[model samples]
Target chain A: MSLAGTGPRRDGPARGRPRSEAVERAIVEGVMKLLEDGVPLAELSIERIARTAGVGKAAIYRRWTGKEQLFVDVMRAAEPPDPELPGTSMRDDLVVLLESLRLRGLAGRTSAILHNVRAQMKSSPRLWTAYHDTVIQPRRRVGLDVLRRGRDNGELRADVDLELLNDMVVGPVLVRTVLRPDAELPADLAERVVDTLLQGLRPS
Target chain B: MSLAGTGPRRDGPARGRPRSEAVERAIVEGVMKLLEDGVPLAELSIERIARTAGVGKAAIYRRWTGKEQLFVDVMRAAEPPDPELPGTSMRDDLVVLLESLRLRGLAGRTSAILHNVRAQMKSSPRLWTAYHDTVIQPRRRVGLDVLRRGRDNGELRADVDLELLNDMVVGPVLVRTVLRPDAELPADLAERVVDTLLQGLRPS
Candidate 1:
């Protein structure tokens, strides 16, 4: 757990990269531990994280620009790995993407980690913006790309607004995960959301 | 503005009702002013609010159960009045509901009032739950009722889960108002969301 001296050294290219990764992991894990322990984000100073991780402050600063950037990494580390889209069809790809979100919702650790961080981040504009730019927007872009491709391939209505469509498609997952945490996220949630949406809401 | 002596009195039945209403308005507006002035919720005490409103603490306690309940009234006082459903059709009613949300988004003061309150409320489960129970849940019930009515009238697919459908219908608005504040809430947003979902995302 003491990652002090294992940090990357300028002179030691032979093993520096692996040591650097270790230092990075230690720093990120240190943040996760603090959040999981109910430490308020406002009180989580870099010095505290460094002490907890047993690493030098320089080790953390070398990896991230600021607290916001560091928290982004903590979020990324705690998250389930992003789904690898099947690329076979837009519907299939969308299900995979949404399934990843559903899995994230099911993971107790991710929710625990986010519960405090998300609460504080909203009050801090800088932190909220950084999270949106780095974490949310990139994921949004992936969905948009899938939708755009689907439109081109005649799988989607060409006249549709992809941006709005993307929001609609992803809206339910976000609502359940963020707004109504108590709601059941059943195993077939991804399929239910996608299929229900595709079939439309109107009576035939 | 000095509502100290105007509070309801047991002996004065004829004038007591109006005086009580004035006292209530004074207390609610006082809280709004403090919040608008950037007072953190943690620092907002009943004593401080009474002092700010030129009313006795007994006056506030007589009306509200606690700080949580008082804040609920503050939210109510600050909000645009809830949309009156047209009851012409489910689609029209939904459009009116969402249009009200869009207007709330467009209103600078409502956003300003909610900005700090929403951020801090998330950290305080008691306050967040109070607001949800008092404000969010009531609005959600309205939407659910409409969806249920739609299903009964054969305007909605019988297979749809009303709870999830309600979320889907309101999800886009919440995203723009709460999550992505910068997203444009166009005038036609409600119609677009309803029509798009009704038509489905697939190619016709």
Candidate 2:
């Protein structure tokens, strides 16, 4: 159940004229690498990352309150900004959008970060809200945009609730991937999802 | 966060001569009681249940392999047998069908068992599958049957894949209930859900 995170705490602050930006980048990259490789946070020690990153552990702690905070950034690192795409065709747009989710889910780095996010969300509502603001909202807006576009394009009948559609696109895959790791992904799941959604969303 | 059946074990055997059927029934009821109360498993130990059920710990262990197994049974206990209602009308039938789910999710006993069920699904596939067979499949059949009825009745368009409709019906509520434990039941959530599904399931 334990997944890797940024790592353990360091006691001292960085005592130099200036900390190198390269070191900061290396710390994040090193943590991401460890997590992707299935390193458990229990074993993802700061000492291990320092050795890997060639950066002092003390410098890592100087910049962050804890491993969780650093991992929050790690989770937000490469996520797509929006859930939908604006384009000529709604179906084609959604196909690309959902495919992005599929690609991200298939990636070891993204899945690990998502798992960590779920774990953190359980204990920290404040962190959850913050992550929602910094991490989840932009993605939500994209989904909203796609539905709005779909209606305008006549691809979808009007009278559809865009907000509800936005929830549908993200909620299922997110739950299936993050909550049920072993859930089967049909080869045409994205197409089927969009098709089914459009069926409901079509204006009467 | 804790919406489903993660609270206390309910499947273990109760002690006494010939494993009194009456007392075992009482034990199951006791488990449901604790769940409705929002009691965590950590606090709702076997000792408390035994005392509450007036049974011995040996009895509880004899029935279930452990606390987890007990809770699994307690959970499966609440899932209703699939309804055999046969009719062509999807709307009337669905109203009957979804009411069962709402009763379960909104009711104290059922919701508690579900809370524990969700927490454990990711941890143990074996238990989860068993729980599904014992719990979910029964509930699932209700939706599947409704779709069949919808197709037979002129109300639903022909050529609709009932399986997808099945997912459409149950998946969203589950997503809402699990992701946001405090999610308000929108005044029209049920009607909207049925309407939306009908719109999708309708023939082109």
Candidate 3:
């Protein structure tokens, strides 16, 4: 399955040349696949992935530090935020980010990784802590940007609390994805959430 | 620990009395203590509990089916929802629910149970489906009710989309609690979320 491409075999074709990319991609893909299939990461293992991906162990270790690093990296790959979209209106920007889920499976990836991350945190507290500060915090900053822009623009009321609004945006998405994979996230949820944040829930 | 306070005591005096509620309470209390002290539930064997509780295995099993069933029941003991606060105001009602985390450790006990549940979901499809439909749905319904109420009272704009609002509320909470346990659910976070739902997040 290592489609290293059918490049011209220059000189004497090497027999069983190392499928280095196959090994890395396979391991990472295997992790994503298991999670997407709802296999919790705690139950995931190189042995199982080897069986699933038909890749060798030596090949996987050659690239990844271990399961932890590999898992974190795989999660990171799924959430590629657009820095270009920021410095704009918060409502418009968040809608763009939130809509990406429909196209790129962001909600699915986020929900899937969560099970794995949760299991890892329970077993390895120190490692999980470091990962959050380094990995998770950076992602959350995207939400922070939206809030800042909203507050700056009169779209959000001048006195709006950024942190609380951040939670509001994040809480529902996190909760919905984890709780019910089948639940739908509409294209307009972000807009409704932002509107509520600025205007208040009371009728005008 | 088996607090066989109700069981017949074979010792001296009226020790042949049935086990007392005090003894049972002591056993459960000991279990919670060990848990808080970082003792793994897997290590909390009946023998260990009985030894710690000064009771018999008979006393423990007499009350519980087995360790897993018993443990599941124990974890299910998250705090019940508080009495509905009297108010037409959404913010006040939410304060009651969000503050209930300390009252129930949405990030603590529920977290632990969810950890175990995620791990076990791999082996038991039935349990996973049951939890998804039962426990998770019930909680999500609470958030949905808030949305529906906002719409009905016109507290939310007539054109507001409720489904999106529900997701906004649930997603972030799960992400915060499951992914980042140390952060407290901020006091004003609910307000921000509610605000976002009603007003658009934009620079007015």
What ranges in model 1 sit over 4 Å off? A1-16, A37-62, A108-111, B1-16, B108-111
Q: Which digits, one per residue and each the tens of the lDDT, describe model 2 over residues B97-192?
A: 655555555542345466664564545767676666656665577678767766675566676566655655655565555655554445455556
For model 1, residues B151-183, the per-residue Cα lDDT tens digits are: 999889999989889888988877777678788
How well does candidate 3 score on lDDT at residue A103? 34
Candidates 2 and 3 compared: the better one by TM-score is 2
Off by over 4 Å in 3: A1-75, A78-88, A101-135, A179-182, A186-200, B1-24, B34-39, B43-69, B76-84, B87-89, B102-154, B157-164, B170-175, B184-204
Ranking by TM-score: 1, 2, 3
Compare candidates 1 and 2 on lDDT and give the better one. 1
Please identify model 2 stretches exceeding 4 Å from their true place. Answer: A1-22, A34-51, A57-66, A77-86, A108-129, A152-155, A171-181, A200-204, B1-22, B32-48, B56-69, B76-88, B99-127, B200-204
Candidate 3 docks with a DockQ of 0.42
Q: What CAPRI class is candidate 2?
A: acceptable
Docking class of 1: medium
Q: Which DockQ values do the candidates obtain, in the order shown?
A: 0.68, 0.26, 0.42
Winning candidate number (lDDT): 1
Tens digits of lDDT, candidate 1, A157-200: 88988889888888888788877888878898888888887889
